[model samples]
Target: MAVHHPATIVPTKLELLQAWVPHQPWLGGADVSTVTRLGSYRFDDPDGEVGMETHLLSTDDGRVLQVPLTYRGAPRVGAEGSLITTMTHTTLGNRWIYDGCHDPVYVTALVRAILTGGRHADLYAATDGGLVLEPATTHVRGSGSWSSADVPALTAPVVSHHGTTTTIHAGVRLTLPRVLVATTPAADASLSGTWPGQETPVVLATVDGSS
Candidate 1:
């Protein structure tokens, strides 16, 4: 489950994304003002140290983008290049945000979820009384593992940007589609999800890993 604190963030998520997304090489020079958030999903950090979230956005010109982000209490040691922006949370104090692709915690959770047939993390709002379930706006699922052993670590992912796909090499290869499509080609493993207006599941990412 993911718990959301009812606190104010100095630079809201959208605000930070606006200032950051345009600089991405794959964005085709689209600015933040033309971006619209379609939906999002979350993954839980078993250790409860990092906040993992993925947002699906669309450009005015009809290009879909998948952005995964991780929020941590302190700076991620060697991820200076992936830092999005820092923000002050009224209740939690400070938060350091980074592109999830470069964060091991996020990469592990994603790989584990795909290998274990895990679903998106359920969300809850922290209220004065207690935690209240927040209806998930998106639904996601992954193909489970074929073995019982723990998922292996992928030291440092080497990323390659293509026109419509972003490939990451870290022992295993992960392909994330930059353009969200209704129908997906066959893949070795995959993560898929559905949103409110879109009843059909959209392929989020595909994995090619050795057994």
Candidate 2:
């Protein structure tokens, strides 16, 4: 589960995206003003060191894009190339943002989610009275192994395919779709889900280990 602290963040998520989105190779020349968030989901870090989030956005032309992000208390070592931006949080202080593809926490959690049929992490909002369940805008379901404990951490560099897929080279190859589609290719393991107004199950990612 994910817990949200009642803290303020400078340059909100959308604000940061506005400045960084246009620099992406796959979204070259795209206008950030027209981008709209469709929904989002979260995954918990077993170690509780980082925040993992995935946002689904739609471009003005109707292209659906998936953006996975990781939040950290400090800058991620050797991840300069993947840095999205740095911002300050009212309670947490400075935070470094990176593309989730380059973060081991995110990679491992994603693998575990797919390999264990994990569902979206439940969210809780910190309030004066107590914690309250926050309704998630997106829902996710996975299919594969049952235990995430056996999954090892990713040690090698993650590979990107045309910005549409992210591949982690661990003991077994894991791939996550960066673009949403009505139909997706099958795999040894996979994740699918729906969002508000979209009832059909859309493939979110796949995993393959046959070599």
Best by lDDT: 1
Residue-by-residue lDDT tens digits, candidate 2, 8-53? 7987887777667666655533445567778888999878889999
lDDT of 1 by residue, 90-115 (tens): 98999999988878888777777777
RMSD of 1: 2.0
Worst 10 residues of 2 by lDDT: 24-33
Model 2 TM: 0.90
TM-score of each: 0.92, 0.90
| Superposed Cα deviation of residue 90, candidate 2 (Å) | 0.9
Please give the distance, in angstroms, between residue 187's alpha carbon in candidate 2 and its true position after superposition: 3.3
Clashing pairs in 2: 115-145
What range of 10 consecutive residues in model 1 has the weakest lDDT sum? Answer: 25-34
lDDT of all predictions: 0.82, 0.78
